[model samples]
Target chain A: MNYLHKELYNLLISDHHIFDFIRESALDGLWYWDVENPENEWMDGKFWTTLGYDPEQMPHKSSAWQDIIHQDDLKVALENFKKHCEDPNHPYDQIVRYKHKNGHTIWVRCRGMAIRDHNGKAIRLLGAHNEVSALKKHEEILKRCNSAASIGYWEIDFISEKVLWSTLTKEILEVERDFTPTINETLAFFSEGKSKTSLLNAYQNAISKGESYELELPISISKEKTKWVKIVGIPQITANKCTQIYGTVQDIDLRKTNELKLREEREKLRISEESFRANFEHAAIGMAILNEKGQWLKVNNKLCEIVGYSQEELRQLTFQDITFPADLDADLVLFQELMDGKRDHYQMEKRYFHKDGHIIYIILAVSIVRNNEGKILYVVSQIIDISELKEAKNKIHSLLKTSQEQNNRLKNFAHIVSHNLRSHSSNIGFMIDLLTNENEKLTEKEEYKLLKTASNNLAQTIQHLNEVAMIQTTLEENLQAISLSNSIKSAIENVAAIADAAQVKIINEIKPDEVILGLPAYIDSIVLNLLTNGIKYRSENVDSYIKISSFHSMQYKVILFEDNGKGIDLEQYGSQLFGMYKTFHRHPEARGIGLFITKSQIEALGGRIEVESEVNKGSKFKIYLKNEKDKKPMYHR
Target chain B: MKKTKSLCIIDDDPIYTFGLKKIIEFGKFDVETIFYENGKEAYENLSQVISDGESLPDLILLDINMPIWNGWKFLDEFTKLLSEPSVVVYIISSSIDPKDREKATEYQIINSFIVKPVSIDKIREILQSN
Candidate 1:
């Protein structure tokens, strides 16, 4: 030190160039100050240049450096200098910032020493500056990177039994920078159970065994806020003993929460898939999945049973291959419509060729599966076997046809009976007429009178049979729209003589606009027969009157034939009034065939006959006929 | 009334024909009566008489529902043979069926449709009308 001091003093008084060259090469700059005269100081040229200023433009004075120095850094330097002067053992070294001539900060390592005269009075001060701005900039970048990545450092010093937290670690724990927690307090940030235990074990291993560990653990920042963190501990071992344990704590809450949700979704999807599989396997009806080209991609056991094929066999064939030719086209048309996006699903009764070669009838329902873009993925078909039902329906149809044929034959036989009886009755009448005209004595005989009566009875019976047969043979197709009032008028005209003789007045009250659909002949017969019946059954005690009126029912045009005469006892004869050969009255003209025929005629026109009568007050016969404006079609008897 | 020179009766029922003939005779008309059992027989004999250029009966009674050919079938064929027949014809039927009465009106040759059990008075009226 004496030799270097001798050389530096020799250079300072002799060749000053070498001393200045050594200062420029060894340090950023050097300074000298006169303590007694505080403003008097000298700064080397390198200091000004380091601050982005030309040395010749800077003054060689203390104030020149102080003006460019950071205000906070200047105070630190001054304090350090005062301590150093009071006790030379104290180092006057620190990092200080200076403003560059370009308006940017320049960081420098500044050191100073106080030179004192005899009796410890400081006379001069010397200082050195070294630029460290680039290194400082790099440290700032790393600090920002750690905060951006949500990573923070923590340390446990075993020797001092102290815990240290970085600024970001304090931020993550929601603590103030002044908070200095004990080691146990730091461990309290871990969750109460598994998280705390796991971290404690990892910390113990790190301290005792010098083991490094990484763990994802749950931690609580406050009473209500919880987070998941990836905590890692790396041990620093010295002399085979851990001196410190330090690592990083990273926030992983977002990733772990998403992972948990994904797992739950996967579990739910798996359960749904299992249930769907069970349903598909155990379904009652046949089910199948097929490609758009009609190829079977899958078939359930029920489907195989319905088609008389195995599942594997069905998968080898397309629907078109097994479909009955006659029904295939219709099925294809509907399927095409589904594929063309015209329909979402379809149902049709179709026939298929069974594996055993017989035709099988089925009701097939089909729907499509589609991708998100609306392209068809596949087709799902449900089939129900209907062959047995079809067979039963055919049997019923044939049975109905057979019954209809038998009924027609019976009606024809009735006609034949009437025709044959009429011929024989005509012969009998002729014989009776001849016998009576030829011999008066023969006609006077009791036997001859009896024979005439028999013949008359035979004629009447034949007439009744003919009338019944005519009603049966009448076809609904022969019905015409006949005015009700006109028919009643004509019937009244025909019965005028008889009605007048009996003192029975027949008043036609039917409106002229009322029309009915019926056979013209049958309508006339019914009206006339009712008119005669009203007159024939007239009470001898009162003035007999017959009234005809028309109205409408649900599907029928009703004509009411009311009479003020010796009415029938409805309770006694109501059920038998419309029966053939039924006799209710003692009148000779009560053949008992009129009401029966009328009822049959009404029924043949898709109508009915209803009667209401009292013993002596009056009788009402309501005849229903098909209404011309009604929607019901005429029905044949 | 013009006296009927000849009368023809076509009926399948012998009793009906006999009674009708007896009535015509009892009326004391000087008319010669001819009878045929069915429409076919009457048609053949009448067509022959007309082709032979002989006069037909003044009045002819045709019965429907006969054997071999019905009254309607005979009328159809007989009318084609004669343009305007001079004979007055009547349809006699035992059938009370109104359909037969309505069908008889379709033939221009038929003067009237009469139901069976015709009274002697009706026969007398027919004879005088003829």
Candidate 2:
């Protein structure tokens, strides 16, 4: 025994005062009991006082303390005391709960020793008491915190080849409280792929190099469940060798899954943004982004090419700067609508000024982007160059104007030629007639006959020219409303003698009130010519009849003259039917000038004529004239 | 029958006037024929005759295509001067254009329109009608 213990034993045996002094100095609570009597016992005042009790009011029996002790703890204490009395090998130290005077439990650690007689039989029991309620409360708080935080503690001792796991750590690994795991078995809890390999490498490095690591890895909890865990391994080094490694294993499965999902969303957003950038940079049509003030924010390569500017140069300029001055007002008006929230997009054919100072035609489409509050953010514009198309259109317009002017000049020249020619031919014929009349012997001469024939032909040719010139000259003459029936009746009367000689019946089917817009002279001439033609070309096989009718189309008045005559074959004579001097028949009067003059007169009234003819059946001549009654202003002069 | 006692011919073409005078002679019409080169000359000489208190020509043949004054202008001025002309008038021209014929009818002084190269029978018809 140590001197202190021997002195304590000597004080306990020789003097109770010295033992009391020792107890007061070093112990919180002291006790003494008589094992042989089993009832008598002593407890210091401080022991009752620590439990919120007064020693004077307490019982001096062992059962008094027993009744106040926890029932389960009393049973354990009794068993341990019995074992200590029998073999004196088992310890009699235990943490027990005691009821306090305030009705709350107090925690205490009790330690006792048996005082034996010479025969080694138990005589008395002496014990010390330490109140540990604050310590117990702190331990309870730590365990609750670990469980709440899903943090478990673990340690590995390399020298002893031992592994220790806290109660919460065992729970994290999903093992029973009594189950023990070796180093390799503990490592098996990590998932079989990256987690296992990384952990194994980390552990090896820690044991050999005394390095530390903190890693988040996945752990298999069950056949179908995997959990993410954060492990921190800290190696304890002694003399430059690793002797232990210990750290926390935390369950981070929820946090890690949410983090992974957020990263995937970010990656997807990045890819979409990249693709949009690619499309903008390489678009087929010119594209640009502009601010609300019309300043260019970004321009694609195609836009640069169309505007004949570098992207850097364009970005410094506003859209209004490059826009053609005449086209700016229209573009701004539409832009104002977008700003006012009246429209979101607009499209127009607009002009822009190229860098080289030429006008460029473009089809521009603009769309405005707005914020949640409806404020304009920016505008996107798509431009298609149409300069080539505009140039071609302008070229065609000028060509059409030139051709129309030339055609008018040609008509004027033809009229002048016919007028001058007619005068000369008339003089020649008159001289020929005078010669034939004055000198009857000269007409009987063969050469005189030829001269007469030639003179007659010259007059006929001049007459045809005069007829054609009349149409050209009368084109601009004022037209009057003429009664179709009256005009046709007069024409029939004029050709009545010829029709009667040809034995041709004439039928007028026109309504008596039918009226048309034309020069009265032209109407008379056109009707007379058709009447003469019908009589002259009467089919010998049939009773020739000439029918005249009038009808109205959408914008024209149609006059039809149907004749049962030896109709000219249209297929053989269609193109030359209206050509001047193109005689198609051997009739002595088939001068071919009548139909030609008729077609020309119809055209002078802004009309057209069509002929439907069969070789021997009949011919139908339809003349289409403008129906100017309802709409006279367009055809007036 | 009223004889065409005095006749006047206005034309720019000498050949046309000659042929017309020959036809009148061949018709054996007892008429004195006078000739002017154009409408301006005819108007001046006829105005002098009116001013001198001499009788106007019994008939006047006017040509449309002329220099200085066309036939239509002479008729317009002369008709305004004399509201009703005692002399018969005919508009004779080589122009076969219907517009020209239509225009001649607008004048009260005009008696008729005759196409050029007047044949012997046409002249006899005109003299006998007068």
Candidate 3:
């Protein structure tokens, strides 16, 4: 009993100041109990004072602790205390909650130690309770932060080459909760490709060089499972050497996949824009892009060259500034229609004034580009240079007019000669008749005979002139379809006496079914003239003959007259052979009028006559005439 | 045969006039002859005769193409001064153009159209028909 009292009395009186100092220093509340004397329980003054109460207002007895203890913690408190009192080796150390004077539950770490006698039975219990609610709250917040961020901490020991992963880190690696990993095994979780290589390098740099690194990479944790993680590693150096590497491994798979998708989309957009720019620049035709205000937004090199302006110079001007005044209104109407969305595209031939103030004809095809919501964005214009084509068209028009004027002059010549010839022939005939009546007064009748011969020659000249006039004015008469074979037969019969006198053989091979559209009289005149001319030029050495045949070609019916005649030298006199007053042969009867009239008649009837002759060889006169059965009449005259 | 008081011929060709004069004299038609080288000379002389109220020619021959103020233009001025009821005008030209013939026929006072180089027989027939 004295030993027990000495422990208490000495602790309270001799070292009572030390006991008070320990109670004040170590805990917010303190208590002691004498188990043999249950009535001798004492609660420290701080026990009540820590709860914002004066010791006088609260009982100093240990029985008062039951009321102050939380109701929920009372049963636990009594059981733990009794167990500690019954056993000397057992310690009472636990966390419990207590009710504050303000009716709030306070979390405290409570520790109790028991003192026992020689019998090895606990006699007194002494305990300390310290409030730890704020610390525990901070620990809870840290756990929440880890879960939200998907962050897990890991550490690698250099000595043992072993790895320690937090509970969240194990979850990230898709491993079991009880699993322990080696440094090599943890590195195996990274993919075997580029990510693995990079991860290995980063791990080596962190451990060997005291370097810190952060990387996001793809990692394969299990079979058929891949994830992306952001790793941040920092080195811990000891004694100027790296001894540990530790970092966080965050699951960033969703964010990284989305970032990759965004980058790929941006790359595609860049490629398409490059392609559009390239096509516009290298196009063979001029191309331009203009904004809604007709301002040049983009112009290709071809357009700049056509307008004779540099890109910088052209950027300051609108489309209207370069357009020729005459074509502006028409082009504007189309442009306005496009702006109003009434028309999507328009094409027109418009002119532009080059920088040098010269005209350039262009065919413009323009279209409006619109946004997805149908708002006008820009105008895409294409230009084709047609200045050369326009020049060619103008040249052709002038040539046609000149040719028409020549035709009119020929008609005029025909008209004037018709009247002049008739007048001359009539005068000669009248003079001849008057001279014949005065024959009695003349001494030489031969003089009168010479005058008569002059009149007869004048009549012959008039007849030839009439024949030319008929060819020229054939268009004024009705053109009728005639049978070529019948015409040839008639011409042959008409010249039968002459052919027979010359002993000429006529071989006619023209088909009876073949037909042509021509004036009847002109056809007879043409055939008769050819036959007579052939007879007139018949070869003296060989048996004279004329072979006539007709056949159809693609666009014309060709009539061939092959003759065994004394063919003239066409190389020397070829051009003049069909010319009026151009006689080739020395025969007195050879009048050049025949071929000239024949050519004119053939041309007027929409046919062409070509003579192929070699000095001694036969002459083949090829006449290409229209085959009326296949198509409409080409030439009325 | 009908007798004519006066016959007038307007032509630029002297040969045609000489032949017509010989034919008329040979055929013995009773008519007076008057001559003009072109429409201008004939129009002036005839306009004086009409203004003086003198007797007009019974027949007039007009040529189409002349040196000055040809037949068509002369007709425009002469038609306004038309007062003689017995005078008949005939267009004498060598043109075979149908358009000329149609245009000459439009004048109501024109008797007929005749091609030049007049013969004796045609002169007698013209005198008899008139």
Candidate 4:
């Protein structure tokens, strides 16, 4: 019977190997202590091993474990263990450090329970020790991640409805470390309106349904300061009921600021586009957008008005199509450079074909539009129609030409005046010199002849200058309608004796009804000069024949005077035939003034005179006079 | 100083030429006078005399305004005929233009530019100075 009882006890002990197997696999140590006697303790070999000790060398006593306990944790571990021994029902749990065999400390977690007799006297304590060094290192890693990410954890007790904040959470909120806030007080820290409401709803939903949620919300930790945070809420469930709410809170203020700045930049771009549109549409100068082919992409009202083309029509045609042919190649070359990105802008004075097919000069300034990468987008052309300015310029050129011609005439007149005046004055000086100088022994008749010649030259020069001045100042109102036949007859009658002496026969073929608009005295002078010239310059070896005739032609009364005399060399004197003091013939009676006065008088009456002659042939003078009806047709008729 | 042996007047104006000739003759300046109508005729006659190895006129009165080959052009051609620069030249002209006087001064062969009408006293002074 004694042998059987010892065997039963061994069976009971070996059956407990399952617990030993679990402790060994979990890397835990097992221990037992006698509460009835303060010195009785039992430590598994694994416990000594965890403390870096050999159990075979150590005695089994409470002092053996007490000797390895860390000094700072010994008191707290002993007090908690004493409480567990005294109550016999209290849960025993503690985290403490044990000294290693190498003199360094190792972290450990101890859990234990009290064993009592039927009378409730505590007999022993059973516990397990976990070498929590790796777990502690893992916890430190999690804490560092949270701090680096600016993330903090939060918890809410469902039963107490109170919120608990971690150290990082308190730091993020800029709150005191010891401050414990209720759920309502924590919600009050959120922004007053939509943020607070959304956060409360999410929190309540998480607590009720054991759901997890994430929200980005703006929270105001103080009266005036606000920050953006990402809130992640997870509910803790036990028996399928939510007991606690816990989540992470991340400060996202920097990201939120960047987003807001991006939105403001977008709004500024929109405003810039609006301003560009307004300027393009309402600019005073003509503006247009053209494609690479020079076709108008868009045109403003000013452009349409300038080209006299409708917007639709302008868009349908390229600029080259409407440009004047002369200006096409030059404008095209500049446009090609713009397309190649060689030039940013080009300006030129160009001509375009208007709607009416006339060339209109314009000053065009064109700029190339480019994308960010320097690709040509389109061309913006500004056209300034300078047609009127061009016209005025042309007018000025014509005026300059006329002014140059008039200046040349004035120079010629000055030369002629100088020559005539000098000849007469020099003659007078010669006469005086001859009369006073005792060295020159002049005869009386010779002296008288020289004096007479000087006087005649002086008088002729004065008379010719007076005639020029008279013609210049005479008004158009001084002209009148004079009978052509009567003027010719009177002139012929004045030179009758000279005509008879020269054996010149005058034939009057002038129509009695023919009349011309002229100054009467000027008409008399012109006819008298011509007739006398015909008789005075008569051929010395031949009979002189003078035939005069007048006829009515279109818009003029034409008078023809034909004289059979030595004709002039028209080619040699054609340009200066009527020039003042220009004499082609060397006749003694040729003062070189008759034709000059005749030409001036005819011009003053708005008529013209032309001569037809050859070197040896007779000469014909065709005088064109304004017909009476042609002068003021409506009034005269 | 010796009086000039012979003097020549080349002018188109007959009255001025005749007056000048009489003044030179009556001055008893001991000079035979020669006359020509224009510069062309005068240059031809003078060139012929020089080519024949005859002595040129001691003094020449050249007129500026003439029908053909006036005084300035004549002087340009006349200098080529004679190597000696001793013959005195006097320019007589009715032109009061300053440019003419300036032009006359540019010719080194010309002695003086005189404004016509040429007086006997001015001629007398020129002869005496020469």
Top of the candidates by TM-score: 1
Candidate with better TM-score, 1 vs 3: 1
TM-score of chain A of each: 0.60, 0.54, 0.62, 0.49
lDDT of each: 0.86, 0.86, 0.82, 0.82
Output the lDDT of residue A22, model 1: 79
Query: Candidate 3, what DockQ?
Result: 0.23
Please provide, for model 4 over B14-33, each residue's C-alpha lDDT reduced to its tens digit, 9 standing for 90 to 100.
88877777777666676778
- Residues B35-108, candidate 1: write the lDDT tens digits: 88887888899899889998888888888888999888888888888878777889877877677788888887
Backbone atom clashes (below 3 Å) for every candidate: 0, 0, 1, 0
DockQ of every candidate structure: 0.44, 0.43, 0.23, 0.21
Q: What are the per-residue Cα lDDT tens digits for candidate 2 across A255-282?
A: 9999999999999999998997899999
What are the models' TM-scores?
A: 0.62, 0.53, 0.58, 0.55
Please report, as a value between 0 and 1, the fraction of native contacts recovered by candidate 1: 0.46
Worst 10 residues of 1 chain A by lDDT: A469-478
lDDT tens per residue, model 3, A199-268: 8898788877888999999899777989999999999999988888888999999999899999999999
Q: Could you tell which candidate, 1 or 3, scores higher by DockQ?
A: 1
Please give, for residues A293-346, the per-residue lDDT of candidate 4 as tens digits.
998999988888888899999989999988999888999999998888788999
Q: Which pairs in model 1 have colliding backbones? A: none
Model 1 C-alpha RMSD vs. true structure (Å) is 9.0
Docking class of 2: acceptable
* lDDT of candidate 2 at residue A408, scale 0 to 100: 82
Error of 3 at A176 (Å): 11
Clashing pairs in 3: A12-A16
